[model samples]
Target: MPLSLAYAADFPSFADTVFILPAGTTELPINAAADLPEPVRAYVASQLAADEKLISINQYTHHHYYVVAEAKKTADLTAEALRKAGNKLHALLKTDKIPELFINDLTPDGALALAEGIALSAYQFEGYKTDEKSKKTPDLQLITLVGPQLSTEKVQELDGVLQGVYLARDLVNMPYSHLNATQLANRMQAAGDDAGFQTEILDFVRIEALRMGGLLAVNQGSPEPPTFTIMEYKPEGATNEKPYVLVGKGVVFDTGGLSLKPTPNSMDLMKCDMAGAAVVTGVLTALAKNKVKLHVIGLVPATDNRPGGPALAPSDVITMYSGLTVEVMNTDAEGRLILADALAFAKKYNPELVLDYATLTGSAVRAIGTEGIVYMGTAEEQTMLELKQSGNRTHERLVEFPMWDEYDDHIKSSVADLSNMGKAEAGAISAGKFLERFIEGCPWVHFDIAGPAFLTAPDSYRGKGGTGSAVRLTYDFLKRKATV
Candidate 1:
């Protein structure tokens, strides 16, 4: 269960409480330590050893619960440390399943990080489970922070961002049966309604009428039709004259079309292929909720790449939304195809800048497995630097792949305008090179999140399934733009 967070203005005394202590904190904050029972006081003073540990103590009167969480001091508090501390605290809470946790004496940054760790650590995808008791997770219902500087505004903003992350993760983790293109579009529309944004979903008929050949070519395999989602958020008094466009590749489940992936783990986690779309939806949700003073647009072209009847195959050439042809060298390289259509369509906006996200290439995953996002951009140096800084701040570190002109040679086709698949070497850079063709010289950034979008094993605060990879990174970038 995701932790519900709110600022407790009245600050009621709960039967269960948690004290967050800094590193080497032998004594708790005076207010919290003074109210603690003698045994709990002695235990906190004696046994609260170090950061990244949680100790729970019980009181004799009514068996009240008292827990102490040790987080590294502010000077030592990096994003990784805060996340680790939150994960440690969550691991302890799983055994106790505390309904309400009140954390005392935490800074706003620490509280937000802890909330992220707690919420993400508690994620579980048990949609298919039949047994009610067996399909349970920790019920960490509400978490309240007690600190002098923890303002209601900060708490609300953090709560909104956490909700967005949870939503993105849930969308990415769902099975293809439950979250196909149409269903995903519906979910996007619902999210837009909730966040006061505008959503327009164009179905297959509209897609065909618009001649989105790339999307059509990919959907030729699956019985389920494709969908193109356009979402926009323009708050009153926004500063930007033109919107910032975000495009996402929405291959719901890529079995590689005619060029199929091998059985087992390779194809098993294909449901996470839509993580790019989920992140754009999530970032827009957060931006809208906080009413960031900037106009933003999100475009998602979604479909499942299966090997059913009339599936796309190698040597086939298809025209894209930009009226340029692409040689389908390998059907497995389908993400850029769908994304190409959306990227071309984004040119109509005349945006200040454009960014696209995708779990596009396995080479990216091989390059940096679960460590960071593979990023490349043609935007100004300052913009790119800001993005890298945002990634660092959010702990979604970026590994920059060069956009050298030499990579363009890898995608040149003998007959068609370009080839979907490129040389095996520097495969990730070649894929980015192919995407650059559709940008029409507009300042743009691309994020290949294949490495960090989904995980095979749980890592620290990121759970075993979808990691909600780029939501925080992109959200922070936008926030910086709005404020700076």
Candidate 2:
């Protein structure tokens, strides 16, 4: 069940309460701190003396509980730190099967960050589990914020962002057996309906008419048809005249086609290859739900690369939507092909900026592991710096790579204008350079999300499986843009 948040004028009688206080402080920050029973107060003080960051007291006689969560001092606190603290509190409460709890508000920013972390950590994907015992639904469902600092508007904005993150994670975690190319577009349309965005789905015929050769070539291997989804969110009195375009590579499942990937670790998590598409959808949803006054557009070209049909093989040269030919050196390099067509298509909008996200290279994962995003772009230095700041604020950190002309030489082909695969060294930068061709001088950024898009193990509030890597970072960036 989705967790719900409510506002309370004061701490309710006989309700379990969580007191958020600064580190090393024995006194609760609430006005009713003196009203607690002597034994509970003594126990909390003792736990604080021992330097326990979290203190739980079971007041069985009073039929309630008290959880004291110590946060970093205000001078030392950051958004990421508060979120990590919330994740710790969530784990403790969930383990004990606590059904509901009330939290004393700190500052507005601090409270909202804590709530966001708890809600994100509470996410569960048990849809495929048949047995009831196997499903691990979160026990903590209702989170009531008690205190005046957090306004209803602020809480609503936080709720929208959390919902977006949950939506992104759910899409990435879904097996291809349950979600295919057409279904992915339909799901995006459904999200648009719920969030007040406009969605236009272009079927295979439309794609063919547009001569999207790169997308079609990738779809040749699969029985499923391809879909190009366009989503627009333009609120009244918008801040920008030209929309900011976001393109996502939607390879629903990747078997690497003719250049098949190994089954163990390489192909096992291929279901997450479309995580970039999910991030775009998630960001649009958050923006629309929050009613941010910014014009944004999202494009996703989706298909699965299977070897069952007439798949493109090595040494085949294919044309893209931009009328540029690319030699298919490795079928596993299919993501850039589909993304190329979408990036080319985005040019019609005369966008202010274009950003494309994809799990496009294993070279990126090898370089940075699952800790950070590898990005490179032709956007101005100020834009890149702002994006980096947003990433840092959300803890979805980024590591920039160069897009030097030297890397462009690696993708040159004798038979075509370019090659799908580049030289073995600096593979990630070469992939970015390949994509830069489609922008046609438009300011653009490419995020190689192969590393942080999914995780094999749980990481605090990010959880396991799909990490919803770029949603938070991009949403933070867009939100700031709207205000500016």
Candidate 3:
């Protein structure tokens, strides 16, 4: 079940309570301190004085618990730091099996950040588990923010974003057997239905009629057909005249086509190849749910790249939706192929800005492990700066790489308009250059999210498997745009 979050005017009488305070504070809330025994209060004070970050007082005899989470000093506190602290507290509560809890909203932003962490950390995917008992997740389901600073609107916004993130993670973690191209499109349609967005899914015949050769080439191998999903949210009196376009590569499962990836490490986790699609879907869902007054459109080209019948092969030249021919130098480089079609299709909207996200290259993962995203773009400097700021604020950090003309030269094909794969050097940048061709000089940013999109093990609040990497970052950026 999804975790529930609400703003409480007063603390609950019987539920465990958490005091979220800034570091260097020596005292707890008066009412809370009054409830605790004098000795325990002194112990908490001593712990705070010693700069202990978390102090837990478990009174098993009384079946009550109190936790003091001292966030960073006001001067040192960052959005990311507070979130990390919230993740730690979540772990403690889950281990103790606390069913419900109240957190003192001493600091408004701080409280919200902690709540974001706790809610995100509560996600689990055990849908296929046969044993009902083994499928149980954390009992920390209800979280109430108790303080004057929090508002109903803020809590609702946070809940909407959390729902989007959870949805993204769930879709990413699902195996291709359960989530194929058609199913992925169906899920997006369902999300639009629930979140009040408009969804138009272009079926295989429509895709072929549109002459999306790149997507068609990749889908030739799979028994299932391809789908191009377009989702839009435009409220009355929106902020932008030209809608912001977000495109995601939706290779539901990538076996590298005829180039067949090795099963050991490369192909085993291919279910996450569509993480970019998940992020786009998540962002749209959040924006619609929160009623952000900004016109935004989402484009996703989805299909699995398998080495089955008539799979794409090297030296095969294919035409994209933009009518530009691409020489397939390496079939493993299939992400840019489908994304090329989507970016080209974005031209119909005459978007103010276009941002494409994809697990497009391994060079990106090697350049900067799973710690950050690798991006290069043609967007204006101010736009890029604002995006980077949003990324830092959300902890989905970005590293901008140079998109010089020199990199574009690497993708120039002898036979086609461009080559899908460039020379091994600067593989990530070359992939960006390949997609840049389809954008046709429109302002655009390309994100190579191969690194942070999926994790083999849990990492704090991000958890194991699909991390929902860029969903929060993109949503934050668009949210700021709406406010402006």
Top lDDT prediction, candidate number: 3
Model 2 misplaced stretches (Cα beyond 4 Å): 29-32, 61-77
Native-vs-model 1 lDDT?
A: 0.84
Q: Tens-digit lDDT track for model 1 on 1-484?
A: 4677887654555456555555555666666655577777777667655432466665533122333333444323454576776787777777676777776654434566666677678767657888887777667888776677787888888788877888899899999999999999999999999998999999999999988999999999999999999999999988889899999889999998999999896999899999999999999999999888999999999999999999998999999989999999999999999999999999999999999999999999889887999999799999999998888888888888899988899999999999998987999899999999999679999999998898888898888888889999899999889886
Query: Residue by residue across 310-374, what tens digits does model 2's lDDT show?
Result: 89999999999999999999999999999999999999999999999999999999999988999
Clashes of each: 0, 0, 0
- TM-score of every model versus the real structure: 0.94, 0.95, 0.96
Rank candidates, TM-score, best first.
3, 2, 1
lDDT of 3 by residue, 252-284 (tens): 999989998998879999999999999999999
Worst 10 residues of 3 by lDDT: 61-70
Q: Flag regions of model 1 displaced more than 4 Å.
A: 37-39, 48-53, 60-77, 106-109
Ranking of candidates on lDDT, top first: 3, 2, 1
Please give the lDDT score at residue 427 for candidate 2: 91
* Candidate-wise lDDT, in order: 0.84, 0.87, 0.88
